[model samples]
Target: MQAVHTAATAPAPRFALRSSELPIGVVAEQLGLTLRAIRHYEEMGLIACGRGPKNVRTLGQSARARLAAIADLKALGLPISEIADLLGPDGACPDRLKARLRAQLEALDARRSAIAGYLSGL
Candidate 1:
């Protein structure tokens, strides 16, 4: 079966895989991730993949969405732990996600201001 694209409202950018399963190399390429990074994320349990023929790691639709969310959240400065909580078994709570994101934005704002101030003094 061909993999279906995850809904836009599914919480993150979801790319499609030609088939129900895709090799690690293809996933890494499409997601702009490295094979090692993909493996690392798997090791961290941030996402899960399955074993395909020849034992190559294969990522399915759900797994792709999860990895995409992990990458997007990480880019936004969310740690893996927070991401796990956000995507936990109960699924995402809008309130919780908003609060955490708000905090991260505030922290980033402070850091940017500090850097600007430091640069001005130079």
Candidate 2:
């Protein structure tokens, strides 16, 4: 007797692996960060990347967003640790992250006022 395989029992289709085609160096350049800085962020658990067949790091859109956020937070003087806390697994910005950013901005404003006052006294 011959066995019959049903169409409903067919295996699922495989997806093409398009995510591994991104280049790490190009991402770094686009984000205005050094390749070493990108690796450092990965080491700090701030960004994630996939390994290519040859063991090269392949960053995706999420990594690009994280890099952009890191650069923005650094510009705002939030420090690396705080920026890492604000960024999520997929680079989604949480609402509470704004509180920390606001606090940092207040501190920067106070510092700027103090510098201005000192300059006026000279």
Candidate 3:
């Protein structure tokens, strides 16, 4: 069955995949992600790919969204385990996600302060 593209399901203009059930390589190319990285995410249970004709791995719309979300979380310095939890079946509670982001911000602030202190001494 073909997935419908709603505003939410539609890929971002910045990084769009052409179709549902695209080959893993196509998805990687479209998203500017490496094949190994996609495979790793699959191995980590973060995304699941289906086997298309001739047993080729294919990523559907949902998997693409998960991959994008995973990249966003990774960019924000979230550990994979934490990301997994956030993206789990519960579908990312806003309060929990906010708390995690707040923690990350606090950690960054602390690091920045320490760096400034060291610079002052130098």
> Each model's C-alpha lDDT?
0.79, 0.77, 0.82
Better candidate by lDDT, 2 or 3? 3
TM-score of each: 0.66, 0.72, 0.69
Q: What would the per-residue lDDT of candidate 2 be over residues 30-104, giving only the tens digit for each residue?
A: 778888988998899888877664677878776777788888888777788878777666666777687777877
Count backbone clashes in candidate 1. Answer: 0
What is the number of residue pairs that collide in model 3? Answer: 0
In TM-score terms, candidate 2 sits at 0.72
| TM-score for predicted model 3 compared with the true structure | 0.69
Which residue window of length 10 is worst by lDDT in model 3? 12-21
Q: Who wins the TM-score comparison?
A: 2
Q: Is candidate 1 or candidate 3 better by lDDT?
A: 3
The superposed Cα distance between candidate 3 and the true structure at residue 75, in angstroms, equals 2.3
The alpha-carbon deviation from the true structure for residue 94 of candidate 2, after best TM-score superposition, in angstroms, is 1.9
Sum up the clashes in candidate 2.
0
Candidate 2: list runs displaced more than 4 Å: 1-21
lDDT tens readout by residue for model 1, 1-122 = 97666685456424443478889898889888889989988897777888876678999888887787778888887877778777654334467788888888899999999999999999
Q: Which of the two, 1 or 2, has more TM-score?
A: 2
lDDT of 3 by residue, 1-122 (tens): 99899998888665444466788888898878899999999998889988766667789888888888888888888888888777765334467777888988999999999999999999
Candidate 1 wrong stretches, greater than 4 Å: 1-18, 90-94, 113-122
